[model samples]
Target: MADEKQPAVAPAPDAPREVTSKDGSSHEEITTPTRPPGWMYKGFKVFGHELWYASPLFQLLLVSLVCFMCPGMYNALSGLGGGGQVDHKAQDDASTALYSTFAVVAFFSGSIANKLGVRLTLSFGGLGYVIYIASFLSYNHNQNHGFVVFAGALLGVCAGLLWTAQGTIMMSYPTEDMKGRYISWFWIIFNLGAVIGSLIPLGQNINKVAGPVTDGTYVGFLVLTLIGAVLALCLCDVGKVQREDGSKVIMMKNPSWITEFKGLFETITSAPWVVLLFPMFFASNTFYTYQSNDMNGSQFNTRTRALNNTLYWLAQIFGAVIVGYALDFAGARRSVRAKGSFIALIILTFAIWGGGYAWQKDQVTREETAEEGFVTVDWSDGGKKYVGPMFLYMFYGFYDAAWQTCIYWYMGALSNSGRKAANLAGFYKGIQSAGAAVFWRLDGLKKPFDTMFGATWGLLGGALLIAAPVIWMKIQDTVPLEEDLKFSDETVADVAGAQGAADQAVTAQPEAVRTSKEGGGAKEVV
Candidate 1:
């Protein structure tokens, strides 16, 4: 028989539960994991089994499927076309319109999350996506781009609400020890949309694609969006969430929304955002714009474009999982991690843009389509097999994973106050959106390739170089990066050594020792 496993020993009282931060303040650490996941949701007055939401696995699955339905199928499919592959400009315009609202929508996301909770707020966000996809099917299809823009704004608002709540839940739901792991699971599951959506373009071909898409696509996607929205509705209330130990967090709130609004400003002015998050905001916004306009539009053809999305999304899943381990690496200080990330991101950016700059002329070429109203694009390099540009998306996926993971992890580390963290998440998303909106208006809506490429390098380069240093200097963690096992081992050794020394002292004493008690009873002491 295999040796029986030993149960985990509790920490000794003398073991440090807090650390002195860089700012000279003492902060408590999550010395213990939270309550183990029970049933997803407790049912009735008495329950033995947990609900689906109680399981982190289920929650991950739920969010994954939701992302697939909304952004995965509908948005990705539209990127290169409406039908399958019809009009790039029109579709691109529609996308630009949608992206245009991200700043305003994401700005208010936290306040909305606070009022409505994560579940209902995600539902609100998911519903906009449903409407946007449905709009593509209506007569408004190719008639007016304005309607598409309006619909896109709705999606943006919803996205703002959803992302804020979702970030909060992800950050708050897991125990402190699980923070990195939780973020990894989030991206891992969420990107399923890209994996599945990639296959759709393979069968649909550029010629077969249309303005509103085929009837089956509309009805099928509509149903899919609903399913995702429903899943969002099923999310657990953020306030009344339960920990792994079966302990429930109390739900509390400020007296007014006005007070909450005022608090967001303070969060914006804080160290995490002011010092570390700006470059990330610039980088994320520019990347989204680059992907939307230059890379997705003028750079690659239908099939290759789909491949880019597929590879990027698929790779990000791997990247997210990998980066999660990196962030949680034992005994690795934040300073070391930030430096490594900065160097890696900088190299990747150069590889994507600088290395591929030579092939720019051959990489993207155009031809007149059979339809008078449409323009045909060929991202192929005269069948020369240029692989460099395509790989850029893959590198982007990897960089994206690290960037998102570090930012969120850093956010959790810096802000112990839940309100501040929640607001900061909203602020981060909003700034990201706002930046994208600026890019959409400038380079992406109908941007020339040169401008788009220039912005991509400058923005991403700035992010890696600038933000990386800010992270090293200003972003401090209250929790030590030392591995628990190492710390525990040292503690146990010290305790045992002290005990052994005490025993030796006792042994060295006289064989008989006596002490007199003042109260008449005699007690012997050694």
Candidate 2:
């Protein structure tokens, strides 16, 4: 067949060949040394480095100060100009509306802030807050509840934007190693804000109002809001980074509005587990809203508030520093610890919820007795009479602190890798918003027959408690190979095979040269 064509042969898998060196000498294949993953090592280092300077902690403090200053004024405003003297239901509706706005705005603001730099978004929020407080002052002069609600909505929007940005900034820039610790510190400072906020209202002295108590409270908020705004401006810088090519750039790029709207939806679709964790946030916030309303009603006077705040902060500080360090030391795979913490938090929330229910019942009994003209015990005074409420307050404080600590810890742990943190935070806010919306809508429902608001909240919290451990187990079972394996078996085997082939080639080369010399009249087979 025209001098039969030689069949093509494939290279042997074990064959080795000389590789050229930089100096033109022939050498065998070079080996690359094994090294640890950069993300893991760098993540640890980053957590230790840059977490504290972010301003969420300080911003929370400012918001708390401003928020607490207005309750007395708002109460008075509701009663001004003989406005039918206002009832608990009216106040509840107003508060719900306000908080609902806060929840929704916060969710939207967070997404926008993620696309836009935290500094610019937060600074704008602060300025808007100033405008909101000014509107409140204007409302005080006008005596219009509608204007007050509008102002409150504006405040909610501003607060939502700033808080979302602050949270995102904290979550994004830190290393995985320090993420828990840094977020713990964030909560610690946030609790400190509650302490300070509770105290700021003490300075208002609404009982000794120069004009209406509403007027005095509005003035107080105005001053606090101004201070907050100035601090925000000083702390935030929107346009700061410059590229190597000499082009100025913002720290974050703003995405299209459509992208911002889709963030929550995208997160839920991508991470179904995120949806499961959201109910806990919602339940916790509902409890908080109820407690705030109770406190504002003077159910737990100033001293009680101070004591509760102090205890809460103490527990938070302890949990964050001590428990956070423990989690770090227990190694990176402490899914079990996160589960346990979540369970403990849920138990504590139940205790708080039960205590709140009991407290409400007691208040109703006292009101009924007073209405009947019966001499009631003044348990607000000393010793044994006050012990029950004091015990409740203290326990509630502990519960609040522990619950929040566990929440931050769990979130940090669950969202330790990939793009989980951003997704988790966004979904958490959205779920909390959904819960608030439900509760707000339900507040209009008439009762004494039956209602599901409290029961639904309690059930949601209980479900989350049960779900945490199961989820933790699943996470542990499906631990990523990249995270757990020191080296891939296949990769190691391939490397070993290459080395064996190299050794065989090295051993065979001299014999082949010797044979060639003998066959070619003793000439060297160079």
Candidate 3:
């Protein structure tokens, strides 16, 4: 401060500008390139910036709410109203028909979206959902099983569109580094919606209400459907992204849709492991069928039935959270190791839970009969004698949670790199529907088959559970891409350089030209 300070000298006009890379490398800065208009950065953001907070959350919540309400309405109609024995067979046929339709429609919708883009596809799907819901609400009130089945078929189509588009939107938001975390959060929220959905029926007094279609219960589904339609309209288009040159890039163009569809076919043909994941998914569906069948099949009173549903959802929540966290951590550390080990754990868990149920049924039968001191006990009517252990309920809950977490994470991870995340999700769900269809038929036959029926279904589930790990092991060798980083260092550098160049170019414009353009006149300059 005591010495006189020298003024800073400006750089020479020819002097090179310095630029820094993310890795700390330096380079001569050149005039940056100009970016095309309307290029926006599409990548991960913190908390409120997450894509999950966008329309996806709303869609998910709406879907969950509708799902929750539909079952309640069905249960109230079929079970609560002193209605004659609800045709369980007819219900299965309806569900099967719907699922079959959903599968086919999902495949086509995915292809169409790839062609027409997400917005149109989503809008169409949302509108379809609105129509389907209206139809269902109208017919369900009148106890029109035929119309209900028809409406269900329409709903399936809507589900195909909504689910495919929604899945694509969710996966498109997160970058690789944060994909696992984001997906985990997404599922957690999704399940939370399910929890809320489960509670809707409970609050609406679906079980207690004596009248035909209780107040607010039927209306709740309609409200949810409307909300879903609105949210679907708001979904972000994942197909649009900015290229390095700041040009608009469409991931899948018109001709590319066919190529992508063919690619999906090739993927299935070549990557057999992807196909293998299907059976495990199917096994999980079997459990769901088991639970539904048990609910409908059992003679449990209203309170017990409600308790069963509550427990089922509670277990699902617990399982989803725990397994989701585990999968995330495992993926972070070593994705392959995590996947293999997780699958194995799931398989073992399913085996134990399924085996335990099988054993518990046998044990309870022996205990009850032994207590009666009957040498030749005729336990012909197994309905009165059959008692599932309380512990089995808890075990079943845990198993379901673990199974679902694996399915979601596995499919998400597998399809993350592909343009067909929606299709994959749709296909997986479609297969689940197919499994439900098969098992529902089996459930109908349980009357004549007795305990053998339940045991056979459990065995099939176990077999599928066992197959998952084996298939995963084989598929593990085919390395799928991990999360794709949105803004790589090179990309960032390119952007920064381009921006700097644009600024410099403008700055370098002559004052005379600028003055001329501003109407100061060339004579003034002379």
Candidate 4:
């Protein structure tokens, strides 16, 4: 008889162990103390054991679904050019209102998320999307742009909360090696909401040549967003989540409101390198108004716009996958992947935007000569002019995904702690929203199309130039565990099973600055 195989022993807390991958490869992973099974999943048996509802992947899936129903549906409507209205001005003004509030609230929403917990924050966030969608429905009948703008303002506040929590979880939940793929998965599911939601308008008004989206289209979106609001409540608390390797997710204990703000200030002061990415963040969402209203909305008829919106989101999925795989490729070091992605993005950015520039010039030329403004292109145009613009729009979608994926990956590269991730996410959204607000207001004011277009192109190039040195100097093969876990009074006991011991050694100590094992570390917990 063959010798009995011995049971594998678990690694001690904070011990490094070699973990085998499914591809018959292995790498070292540090194990954090594991928590007891969450009460929510207790006694819920599956295959003779408790189901892991508090699993990292499962919780990520839950968050993805929530975004899918909320922002996903919102994107579908936005893609229809001016929220599927004949006039672009109303939608542009509403967007300006939305981003204006978003900039302010998102800057501080990280503290709110940390205080209220992700579940409540996310649930509250979903409510704004519901109301925003309804505003569109009301506008469909009453044509009250004020109601729409009010809804946008309200949604911006809620969005700040929702997205800060989401960013925390997305950056924190995945293992270091899996961050890219996890982001890709979340993005795919989230955008599916847009793709499926776009179909509602397409199916409802497929035969209609050129007009606003039907009332039924808004109704469909409203229903899905409501479902997402409820789903937000179902997320498991952070401490309960366990990774595939049995380590719990990293989280710092909550401090006072004063302390949290101080922490934010500290982050800004100490990690000033992060400021380099501000231009990139600011430019991130600024292009949406132009893409949605100026390009897709102005150039295509209702049915064709719907079709282009579907293809646009579809391209987003593919773009995310391509970048995600490249970023997470196992053969290269993480730092190598980061540098490689940066280079590829630069190349792709200039190339795609170059195409956009040519297209914009053509549109400008046509508009100058046409007596009645630009004519909307329908599929009936026999693909002469339609196919070229269609491809351009899809590539726009692809570049959007690639750009966003890189930003998220860059943020993820900075740390693995949820608290820090929340702060970073807030800062990112804050700057991004500010830039978007400016651009949306410009579009709303009916600024010259070529002027806005040139600004967008110039900003993208300039931001990348500023961010280049920071990427090369700061990003690394890996983040040190101690550096990542800094800033909280919590210990391994806080996140692990030693719940009763968590508060035993609490003290009012000031923040400590330490040089990380990785050479130059940022400020951390005392």
Error of 4 at 392 (Å): 0.8
- lDDT score, residue 231, model 1? 75
- What is the TM-score of each predicted model, taking all chains together? 0.73, 0.63, 0.66, 0.85
The residue pairs that clash in candidate 2, if any, are: 47-175, 106-160
lDDT of 3 by residue, 1-526 (tens): 5322222332322234666656664445433223222312234334444222223333344343333333323333332212112234445555565666776777666566556666566666655444444544564456566765675677677667755665555454333333444444555554454455445555665345122234354466556556646654554454333223332212343336556577457546645657656666565555554554443224333333334455555666666666656655633443564455465555656565565556435432322322333232111323423234333554566666666656665655554432456557666666766665566556545433235346545655665555555444542322322122121112222222244334434455556423532255421111
lDDT of 1 at 35: 24
**Could you give the candidate ranking by TM-score, starting with the highest?**
4, 1, 3, 2
lDDT by residue (tens digit), candidate 2, 143-261: 55666556656655665666555555455333345555655666555555444443434345323212223344446546655665555544433232211111111122335556555
Instruction: Give candidate 2 regions above 4 Å deviation.
Output: 1-91, 127-142, 203-218, 233-264, 295-332, 350-380, 416-420, 440-457, 469-471, 474-526
TM-score result, candidate 3: 0.66
Of models 2 and 4, which has the larger TM-score? 4
Clashes of 4: 1
lDDT at residue 69 of model 4 (Cα atoms): 98
For model 1, the run of ten residues with the poorest summed lDDT: 481-490
Off by over 4 Å in 1: 1-52, 55-61, 78-85, 139-142, 206-215, 245-251, 269-276, 299-301, 361-383, 386-388, 479-526
Best by lDDT: 4
Instruction: List, in order, the clash count of every candidate structure.
Output: 14, 2, 3, 1
Q: Against the correct fold, how does model 4 do in TM-score? A: 0.85
lDDT of each: 0.58, 0.45, 0.48, 0.82
